[model samples]
Target: MDKKLIEELKLKLLEEKKDLEKILKGFAKKDPHTPGGWRANVPKYDGGHMEEESDEVEHYQNLLSQEASLENRLKEIEEALDKIQTGKYGICENCGKEIEIGRLKTYPAAKTCLRCK
Candidate 1:
């Protein structure tokens, strides 16, 4: 793989990592005990209306789901970055073949080629 292309992918991954963390922080806090862990903020009871309380609960549940999804994507991006460091970037993990450049450009965190995926 070309060094320039790898560098471009690295930049894309880093930018995405930043964006994901920012989005997660809007509704979740970083977990101190585990690396790259996020805990969605729980809605607190302020003795408001019952309807409001229920709405808050529903929002909290949605945040939890979003947090899980973002965390998983972050992990995949981190893994891809690690592969780049180890000189394994662009190789499909499932088939040990070079991933298509177009696919990698579209999804820098991809773990497998289109066929394997």
Candidate 2:
């Protein structure tokens, strides 16, 4: 892999990591007890308004789902960054081959090449 391309991908991954953290911070709190863990904020219930409370619960559930997804993507980005430091950034984890430059450009965190994928 070209050093310039890997540098570009590293920047891209860093930018993506920043964006994911911003979105997760909006509705989720970082878990102080667990590194890289996030907890979705539960909607506060007031006066036990049954129907409104139910809607709030549903919205909270949706936020939880989104939080999980964003966390996973953040993890992937972190792993990719680690690989970059180790000089394994563009290598496919599945087949031990160089990942296509185009695929790396499209998804810098990809672990497998197109064939392995």
Candidate 3:
């Protein structure tokens, strides 16, 4: 891969990481127990109506799902950045082939080529 192209992808991955962290911070906190882990904030409980409590539980569940998704994406971005450092960016992990430039441009965090994916 061209050094310049790799640099561009690295920037994209960094930007994505920042954006994901920002979104996660809105409703989640970093988990000190696990590196790169996030925990969705549980809604506060008070002496309230049963219906309201149910709604809060539902919302908390939704947040948990979203947090998991965002964290997975962030992990992929981090892995891609590490690959860049190791001079293995843009190579498909499954097939050991060069990933299509277009695919990499579309998703810098991609781990597999379109075929493998």
Candidate 4:
């Protein structure tokens, strides 16, 4: 892969990582004991109305799901950046083939090429 292209991808991945962390911080708290882990904020029921409590629970579940998804994607991006640093980026993890440049541009964290995927 071209050095310039790899640099560009690194920038994109960093930007995305920042955005994911920001979004996750909104309704979830980063786990102090676990790296890259987030826990959804649980609203205190405090003998509140049952209906409102149920709604809060549902909202918390949705935030937890989204946080998990974003965390996974961030992990992938971090892995891809590591590969780039180790001079192993743009290689398909499944078949050990070179990934197309266009595909890499579209998805900087792709682990496999289109055929392998």
lDDT of 2 at 81: 99
Poorly placed runs, candidate 2 (over 4 Å): 34-36
Per-candidate local distance difference test = 0.93, 0.91, 0.93, 0.88
Q: TM-score order of candidates, best first?
A: 3, 2, 1, 4
Error of 2 at 92 (Å): 0.9
Clashing pairs in 1: none
| lDDT by residue (tens digit), candidate 3, 26-94 | 999999776559988879999699999999999999998898899999999999999999999899999
lDDT string for model 1 (48-117, tens) is 9999999999988888889888999999999999999999999998999999999999999999999999
TM-score of each: 0.94, 0.95, 0.96, 0.92
Q: Model 4: runs farther than 4 Å from truth?
A: none
Backbone clash count, each prediction separately: 0, 0, 0, 0
Worst 10 residues of 3 by lDDT: 32-41
**Could you tell me the TM-score of candidate 4?**
0.92
**Taking the tens digit of each residue's C-alpha lDDT, what string does model 2 give over 1-117?**
788888999999999999999999999888967555988887888878789888998999999889888999999999999999999888899999999989998999999999999
Per-residue CA lDDT of model 4 for 1-117, tens digit only, reads 789999999999999989988998888888877566877788778888889889988987887778779889989988998998899999999999999888998999999999998
Q: After superposition, how far is residue 46 of candidate 4 from its true place, in Å?
A: 3.4
TM-score of candidate 2 on Cα atoms, chains taken together = 0.95
Model 3 deviation from the true structure expressed as Cα RMSD, one decimal place: 1.1
lDDT over C-alpha atoms for residue 67 of model 3: 89
